[model samples]
Target: MAALHELPSQMRAVYLREYNKPYELVTVDVPNIRENELLVEVHAAGFCHSDLQVIHGQFGTKLPIIPSHEPAGVIVQIGSKCSGPWKVGDRVGVLNFKNACAKCVGCSLSQKRYRNLDPRFCDNRETAGFQHDGAFAQYLAADPATTVLLPSSLSFEQAAPLMCAGATVWGALEKATSGLEPGATVAIVGIGGLGHLGVQFAKALGFTTIALDSRQAGRDLATEVPGGLGPDLVLDSTASDAAEKVLAFTKGEGVAAAVVCTDSIVANTWTLRLLRVGGVMVPLGLPPDRWQFDADVLVFRELVIRGSYVSSAESTRRMMEAVGRSGVRSHITTVELDDVPGIVDMYQEKNFRGRLVVKMRD
Candidate 1:
């Protein structure tokens, strides 16, 4: 293995020793890099809603695990078997899936969306934070194949949320925005963590983006784009005339697509009314209960409802490029590693703005 310097034997980490419990701060051994892996000294890791699901026994009991799959940091070591336009000290973000299985989130949509993924990678992989130890620590052993180089201009905190939140939304938008004509319109429903990013991506990807949300903050964030270029319109999903407003915006045809980013069954089911015929609707949230939709709308409109679990490594790189070109950025609130447990409830609140990230070190 190639390394920058003598590595530390131990590091501080947040450990999930049990389900439905607060993560505990503890010391653990720094991971060693494999020939095809990279040892990253994590600078920032994003706290996602999925992380809360993990703690709530959503993915089953994989006890004594480190949380936070959204990892961005400096590569401190590279495995001898790893080769690319990379070396130690490069800033990087790791795709959580080690080797995507067909049933896994990556392969579920990445194969069809990107068409660059291998079927051989389908069905026998471990996912970071779920099946394998993830980046709630100072260091992470990342698979080189699933890692992307980060832009030098982006901070680790800024880049960390993009690893999953940004990539997942970008992947979902890719499903609907592909081949879209110029001036085509898309609506981002529930502009929260992922939805807010979806608005920027849709606008950047050549679609007339319309932001829809129940909360004023989320709707407000939709218009908070850098360079004074925000979504074309913003609507409160909870508004009585929300659906009518969209229909009117698209001249009674509706948007070219509608991405429902909230887990609200109401949003998931109602947003279907806003898609044009043959439009796509990607449910980006993981709701606790089943989501019911109108079957007649599905058959008549031919609306494409697809599942986008996460994005491929190549697609993630594409998203980074979009970030550069569009000046899209995550509205982040940083907290030290030790402060994570205390703020878990804060992120769970409805008024939480932007992403909550853990700043591991300088």
Candidate 2:
């Protein structure tokens, strides 16, 4: 790998110069790679809703920042003090969270209890495209610890969405089905970017997967899963008695769990009714606000309700392995770097479906 100092001083990047405005293509200084960091030549970056949130100031982001989180690339340069087996020319997937202070209490617990909890201990923590420059650029500097080495067979475009969307659903599924036996039944609510991937992951884990979406279009797209491992049933939530339809599909036993991937409180509230006794409902998507439910439902059903954030590097690796074993493909539409602004507009209008990948490398 080339040394970091040997790289050029500036590179092309997409920046959100102002909130609620379009991202502009501009040349910015190549990030100064830390001793333990690698300068990656970004190949592909996935367009996530969170990026739009940051762009619109929904997340109170600092302006003049790059707006992207799901990035995959090749190591073009390694910092001087960097160590480990990784070398230049290695393809890698980037994690959103940057560096975690190893000495903090949370970091200790994260390392001892669960490495995925490391974000809690992240002191110099900078989420890509938010506090720091993200992968909507030609080059990105990332710590080796947070970057996962991708297999040679995995393309950068394929690995991009897995970094975020795949990890989010994978983590939620892991939490939802921790004690679940093989062949358990699971339902995924809202078959969008996260839900579509969630369906495949659930089925890969040996669950009877059911997908629920608002539109017949989404249902049609989800029903075409590879090898007929598609959803056992696809239902439109717009239809009357949607919850009853789910119950009917489950033979009246209800699903062992339902993953809510929509940021709709109504959807989350109703999805709880679809869970059987002792069933879990894990929310990965952000709702408008704290959800309110009837106390009777919670007490009578003894349902397990929880929220899952992005997964850690370990869980991400597990997700990647699952995708590798299952040969799952991301149904992505490729757009050039210049199209980011227009795509962001489409996203704000909620007009696109499936996952969108920005091809930074042309």
RMSD of each: 2.7, 2.1
Model 1 Cα lDDT, one tens digit per residue, 116-156: 56322567787788867898899999887788998877889
- Kindly report which residue pairs in candidate 1 clash with one another: 101-123
- lDDT (tens digit, per residue) of candidate 2 on 1-362: 46534678788888888887778889988887888788898999999988878876887777788878899998989877776688888889988887776767767777787744476356657788777778899999887767888866678898899888888988999989989878888989988888888889998889998898887767876875667458888888767887887788778988998888888888778888888888999987776688876577778989998778788777887888878788766777888887777877666454566788899996
Model 2, residue 291: C-alpha shift (Å): 0.9
Candidate 2 pairs with clashing backbones: none
How many collisions per candidate? 1, 0
lDDT of 1 at 294: 96
lDDT of all predictions: 0.85, 0.82
The TM-score between candidate 2 and the true structure equals 0.93
